[model samples]
Target: MQAPERIMSCERPDSEEFCYFLAKDYFRFVLDGSESQPAANNVVETLRRSGSSLDRSGRELEHCINKLNLSSIEEVERVLPSLMREIYSDGIDNWGRIVTLYAFCGVLVSNLKKKGVPERELIEGVAQCLAQYTWTHKAAWIKENGGWEKGFVEHFQEKKNSHFYTKIAAFTGIVAAFSFVIYQH
Candidate 1:
């Protein structure tokens, strides 16, 4: 089957917000059941055609959903860590890709919860992994600027540094909030 055309634009490919929106739209499309094919099948086909590392992860995730019956919490527990590790280990240097993966995980976790899966452990594990990665990246930026102590002092003093980190935090918060809303509806 031919993959559906990408509906969202990615002009700001480096922006976390852009990637999060793209992931949200993609998940919404897949989960809404607006297409003739199964959502997992369509997602896999689309990702297989996109040829990006993020898409590759999506394809693998679709396969995992199909193969392991993700509706089951036990199956998710067995599969999620390795899937997360694969995405993390793929050397995806782009923040957009990382954000996309983070959003995808959020959507997946939310969906599983909606399906009545007890997912405290799964949510905590995924959140911890993503949070650690984000912290590591931010720490590197702080180190490059001077060091954590100096950076923290300067971050409050400098409007630019404060604004940058605030934007990052806001984007993360927005994605989390959006995912919760999506799951609720």
Candidate 2:
């Protein structure tokens, strides 16, 4: 199958509102992140079955998560590398580094979960790698790239140093939820 298209627009994933929306709507009860394809479909079906009983916010959130959920793991896996490339893109003055990094963090979390790995270990490892990469190596790239400041400024304005750390917390929640759903089956 053809690779899924990348999200070309640059947006930060640091918003608590966005994270909460993702947490409640997208990753809420993912019992089997590894069985992501079927599990995602099931979750979407569950949401669809719930239908208009949902409020406007609930419906919108459900729809967004449904979009993320319906995509196959094979498709997600195929696009992972390309997503990484965009994170490390050259010459484009891309300010979406942190946003891309956060998204990649989510994908990596999902990938590891789907691999049937331990939830804590998977999320912790990826979060550490991301922190190290951003502070050491990626920091240099940001200094050279003009677009970095915009992303950083916008990302931190909401909650100071919390965004980076908060992502890991959010990821852990999703992974834990995935594990819980798996154990229930």
Candidate 3:
């Protein structure tokens, strides 16, 4: 499940390629009953191949997961609120970031579901977070700037543009992975 090379870039805080690769890798790990160490190593390799740094948000997620020492629904319930807060408050303000959050949540929920854990609460929590911080604000911002298509086009075409398609690819990859996870549930 290799992402296209051209989709890799360092500028985006949550690279779409990285998010998709991480979620896909994690989902596979869960399905395969593999240990977390292999998944983490794969994530590092994927990040390197994508030419994306593991930014603060990614590191924070790793730290939260490691510190919690749980892989069940309890872990998702305990860590998600703080994770969402940090991602929204201090992370990049972009569609990719929002999509990354959605993808991450989707992966967690899917994993829980596969483990036969009741996932309604976690799913609702994710929905609430997205409704409050992501979809609502993103919709308003897009409306204020025109619609999504126009807004994104204009935003990417502005001065100092670099790796515009890479950003779009990342966004697309995240959305695709998010959809896949959601479908699995």
Looking at candidate 1, the ten consecutive residues that score lowest on lDDT are: 42-51
Distance from true position, residue 94, model 1, in Å?
0.6
**Highest TM-score among the candidates is held by which one?**
3
Worst 10 residues of 2 by lDDT: 1-10
TM-score of 3: 0.39
Of candidate 3, the 10-residue stretch with the lowest lDDT total is 48-57
Clashing pairs in 1: none
TM-scores for the candidates: 0.35, 0.33, 0.39
For residue 83, model 1's alpha carbon misses the true position, in angstroms, by 2.1
| lDDT of model 3, residue 147 | 40
Residues 70-89 of candidate 2 have per-residue lDDT tens digits of 23444434443343444344
Q: Which sections of candidate 3 miss by over 4 Å?
A: 1-78, 119-121, 135-139, 145-185
Could you give me the TM-score of model 1 versus the true structure?
Answer: 0.35
Order the candidate numbers by lDDT, best to worst: 3, 1, 2
Pull out the clashing pairs in model 3.
none
In model 2, which runs have C-alpha deviations exceeding 4 angstroms? 1-89, 140-185
Candidate 1 clashes: the total is 0
